[model samples]
Target: MSTITPHKLGLHKILKHIPLNAIFDAPAKARLAKAVNIADLRLCAKARAHKMVFDYLDAGADDEISLRRGKDAYSQLEMHYHVLSGLKPPIDMRTKVFGCDVDIPFFGCPTAGNRMFHWEGETAAAKAAEHHGSLYGLSSLATTGIAEIGEIHKGPKVFQLYVWKDRELVKEVLAKAKEGGFNALALTVDFTWYGNRERDIRNDFSIPPKYSVAQVIEAIRKPAWTYDFLSHDPYTYACINTDVPADSLAAFVNSQIAPEFDWQDAEWLLGEWNGPAAVKGVVRPDDAVKAVETGFSTMWVSNHGARQLETSPATIDVLPSIREAVGPDVEIIMDGGVQRGTDIAKALALGADSVGVGKPYLYGLAAGGTEGVIKALDILKVELDRAMGLLGVGSVDDLKKRGPGLIKRRPASVRDYPDRYAYERGYGGGVI
Candidate 1:
C-alpha cells in the first residue's frame, strides 16, 4: 500500500540510516580513550610521542635479542584451566609485601625520568598506584623527588637506589627516603656500564634533550605532547637536583654510578636504610641465594628490563630456579616484559610473591598521564579477576598453588634454547 504513493525524499530517515557514529565520535577521546589493553596504550604512546622519546623509553641493549626474548619467553608458557572449582565468591588479589598488605599481587616497577614522558610524571604514576591499592617504585633518577611523591601518595612506596659514586649524595638520598616514609628500598646491582642501546645512540638521546631541527619538526607534529613538555618544569633528576651537570643519561650514568659496587657496599647500604630492602637485577640462582644471604628482604629478579645486558636470560625463565634456590620464604618480585593480566598470573604461579611492571605502565603514563596509568591498572585488575575466575582460583595464593602443575613451558626439543643458553652446557665437561 505504501508503494502506491510517490513520497518526497526524507532527509531525517536517510540521516538516521547513515550512522552518525562515524561522522561525529570525536576521534575516540584522543586515542588513549580507545586503548583497552596495555599494548594498545603502547601504540597510542608511540603515535603521540616523538620517535626519539619513544625510542628512549622502548629500546634495549645491543642487538636487543634479550629484550625481544623477555616478552617472547612468557608466550611460550601455557596455563591449564580448571572448571567449577573456584572459591565461592569475590576472588582476592591482596598480598603482603614485607608485612605490609598490598591489594594487588603486582606493583609499578620504577623507571627513571618520568618527566621526559609526560608533565604529570612520577606524581601521576604514584597517584594511580595509590588509587589501585598497590605500591609505586620511585627511581633515584625520578623527576619528582621522594619527599614530593611521599607527600602525595599514601600507599606503599619503594625507593630505587642506583648506588652512585657520590657516597654523601647516596647517604642524603637514603635520608630522604627514610624521611619520605618509603616502605622499602630497592638496590639495582647490575649497572657496570652503559649497555649499548643503539637506538639511543642513533637518536642521540639525553636527559635534557638537545633538539635538532628534525626533532623540532617531529615535536611540532605532536603538539599536545610538546605543549605539556614546554609548559612543565624542566626535566631534572629530583633526587639529586644539585650541581651535577645535566647531560646524556649514559654520560651521567657512566660518570656518577659506581662501577666498583660489591656485596660490602650492598651490606652498608642495607645497614644505612635499616628497613625492608629489595636486591633488584638478580637473575642467577646462586645470585638469588647470595641476595638472601646479603640481608635483603626481597630478591627482585630482573635484567634491568633487558636494558643492562643484551645477553641476559629472560627473567621469567630464570624465576623457577631462583624460587627453588631461595626456598619458600624469600619474597621474589620480578619485572620484565609483563604486558597482560595472564602474564601477571603466570609469574605469580611461577612463585613470584609479586610482579613488577615498568614499560607497560609507562606506556599508559605517556598515553594519558595519571588517568591513563589508572586505566592501565584498572584493565589489569579486571583481567586478573576474570582470569582468576576462569582458572578456578579464588586468590593469589590459590593461583600460586595451582601454578606449578598447570603452567608448562614449550619443549626445548621443539625450539632452540634462547641464544644466551644455545651453547649446550657440559659440552666439554669430561675434558675439563
Candidate 2:
C-alpha cells in the first residue's frame, strides 16, 4: 500500500469546509438536514420538544401494542425484487388521492392540535405538503382554521370532520371547508370516545397546557420551543371552538362528540358535503364494504394511528382484505405505522390506492417546522423512487398492477406461529 500523506488524508480540512456560520444562522435547517430517516426525525423532535409534548405525538393507546406492531407488521412481509426488468430512472410516483392529483403515493394524515407540537403548526405542514405536490389533511381539532390552511396550500387539501353533539356545529365547519375550497372531506369515525393514553395522564398533559412546577422546569430546559410557544398566538381549536367553547380537550371530547353517532349520521354528512368524501378509521373488511355502500367515495383504512384502540390490528395487516372487500373500484387510503418508503411500496403492492402518514410528518414538524416537514416528504419521495427503481417498477400503477406477486409474507416463526390464525383473520395476532 502507498504511504498516506497529510494532504491525501484531509481529515482536519473536512471541519474547515463545513459552513459554521450558516449552520448557526439556521439551526433548524441544520438540525433537519442531519436526519436521514423518520426515526432520525423522531430523535430530533424528542430533543426539541418537552417530554409531555413529544410523548403526546409519539405515544399511543393503553399498552401501545398496536402502535409498536404497526411498524413491526411491515417487516413481516418481504419484497421479491426483479432483476433485468427494463425500468428506467425517475420512477413515476404520481397518483390521484382524494380527487386531487399528487406527485407521491402518500399524503399527510389529519392529526389534531398541531400547535402543541410547534408554533408554525398546521400551516407549516400544509405548505410543505403543497410544495411536494401531495395532499395535506387538516384535522377537525387543528389549531389553524380551515380558511388559513386553504389559503396557504393551493394543492389538494382534505378537512377531517367529527360529528359533534351539535349538528349545526358540524354543518358550520363543513360550510367553511366548502367556502375555503377544500378538496375533500374525511369523516373520522374512530373516536367515539378518547382511548386511554396513560402518558398524557402521567404528564398531566392537556390542551391549553397546564404548566405545573415540573412541567415548567421541563419547558425551561427546551428554551427554543418555549420561546416560540410564548411568542405565537395562543393555541386553541381554531375551527370549532368559535361556536362551542370548552375549558379542556377532555371536556370538549366529552361534551361535543356525539356518542350516538351512527351510520345514518355518516350518510347524512356525506349528503351534506356532496363532494369527494372518505370514511376514515375503517379497518374491517366488512366495514370497508359498508363504507362503500354508505356512499363514501373512499375508505381510509386506519385505526386512528393506534391511538383510539389499544390492540387494534396494524393498518397494513388488514389492507389486503379490505381491498378485496371493497373491490378494485373503491379507493383505499391506508394510514398508520408508515415509517419507511419500503412501507409505501408494500402498501401499494398489497392494494392501497394511496397511503397517509401522521406521526412521521408530525415528527418533522416538531423537529424543524416547515423545512422539517419538507425534509420528511423529501426523504420518503427519494426512498420511494429508489425502492421502485431497485424493485424493477417504473410507476405506481405498475407497482399496483404487479400487486401480490411482487411481495410475499414471510413464514411465521415459532414466536409468531401461535398468532398465525389471528393474522389470517386480519386481527394482527389479537382477537377483535
Candidate 3:
C-alpha cells in the first residue's frame, strides 16, 4: 500500500459536482417528505403520533405471534420472473373488486375511529382511495358519518357492518349505507368477543378516547398532534355515540356486540343488504366454503389484522388452502401484513381477488393526512406496476394464470444466514 498523503491538499480546479436543489422549493410544500415506503411511513407516523396512539395502532393481540408470522411469511416467499417473455410496457393493475372496476389491486380496509388517528381521518382516506381509483371500507365506528363520506367520495365504497346488541341500530345503519350508495356490505363475523389487545389494556386506550394523565403527558410531547386534536371537533364515535359513556372498550363490546350472533344473523344481514356482500373475517377453509354456501358473494379472508387471535394462521399462509376450499367461483379478498407492492402481487399470485390494507394507510394518515394516504396508495401502485414488469406479466389475468409457477413457498432456513449468525443445526437450532 502507498503511504497516505496528508500535506498540500487543495480543492481541484475542475472537479465535477452534483447540482443539488430543494426537493420542495419555496411556495411549494412536501407531504410525506422523507417516506419512501409503507415502512418509512410507519416510522414517520410513530414520530408524529403519541406513543400510546402508535402502540394502539401498531401492537397486535396477546403475544403478537400472528402479526410477526404474517410479516415473516411474506418475507420468506420469493417471486420468480420470466426473463424476456415478450411482455409489453404499460402493465395493468386494474381489476374489479365486488363488481366495481378499480385502477389498483388493493383497497383500504375499514379501521374504526379514524379521527382518533388524525382529524382528517376517514374522509381523507376515502378521498385518497378515490384519487387512486380504488375502494374504501367505511367502518361502523367511523368518525365521519356514511352520508358525508358517500357524498364526498364518488368511487366504490363498502360499509363494514358489526352486529350490535340493538337490532334497530343495525337496521338503521344498513339503511343509511344503502341510501348512501355503498356498493357492498362487508359483515364482520370475527368479533364475537374482543381480542386480548394488551396494548390497549396497558395504555387504557378507549374509543371516544379518554385521555389519561399518561396520555396527556404524551400529547404534550406530540404538540402538533395535540393542536390538531384541540382545533378539531372533540373526538367522538360519530356512528355510534354522539357522547355516550362506556367503562372501557371491552365493557362496551360486552354491552353492544350480540353474543348470540350466528349464521342466522349473517343471513338476515345478507338479505337486508340484498346486494353484493362479503363475510369479512373467514379464517378457516371450511368457513370460507360455508360462506359461499351461505350465499355470501365474497369471502374476505382475514383475521382482523391479527388483532383478534395471537395463534391464528397468517392470512397469506392460509390463503391457498382457503382458495382450494372455496373453488374458483367465489371471490376471495385478503388482508394483513401487506406493506409492499410485492406483498400485493404475492397475495394475487396466491389467489386473492384483491387485497385490503389497514395499517399501511393508517400509517400514511398518521404521517401526512390525505396527501400521506395518497402517497401510500401511489407508492404501492408504482411498486406493483414495476413488479409486474419485472415478473414478465402485463395484466392481472396473466398474473393469476402464472402466479403459482412464478411464486414458491418455503420455510425460512438457518443456513441462509452467515455461520456466526446461525446457532445450531436441526432440533438444536430451536433452543438456540
Candidate 1, residues 134-216, lDDT tens digits: the string is: 98899988888888898888878888988699889899998998889898999998877777889887987764456677777
Q: Which of the numbered candidates is closest to the native, going by highest lDDT? A: 2
**Candidate 2: which stretches are off by over 4 Å?**
1-29, 243-247, 414-432
lDDT of each: 0.80, 0.82, 0.78
TM-score of 2: 0.89
- The candidate scoring highest on TM-score is 2
| CA lDDT, candidate 3, residue 66 | 81
Candidate closer to the true structure by TM-score (higher is better), 2 or 3: 2
**Among all windows of ten consecutive residues in candidate 1, which has the lowest summed lDDT?**
423-432
Better of 1 and 3 by lDDT: 1
TM-score of each: 0.88, 0.89, 0.87
Question: Model 1: runs farther than 4 Å from truth?
Answer: 1-28, 242-248, 413-432
Report how far off residue 392 is in candidate 2 (Å). 0.7
What TM-score does structure 1 among the candidates reach?
A: 0.88
List, residue by residue over 233-329, the lDDT tens digit for candidate 3: 5445566675643224466667789869888878887887899999999889998887888889999999998998778988998999999998887
Order of models, best TM-score first: 2, 1, 3
lDDT of 1 at 158: 87
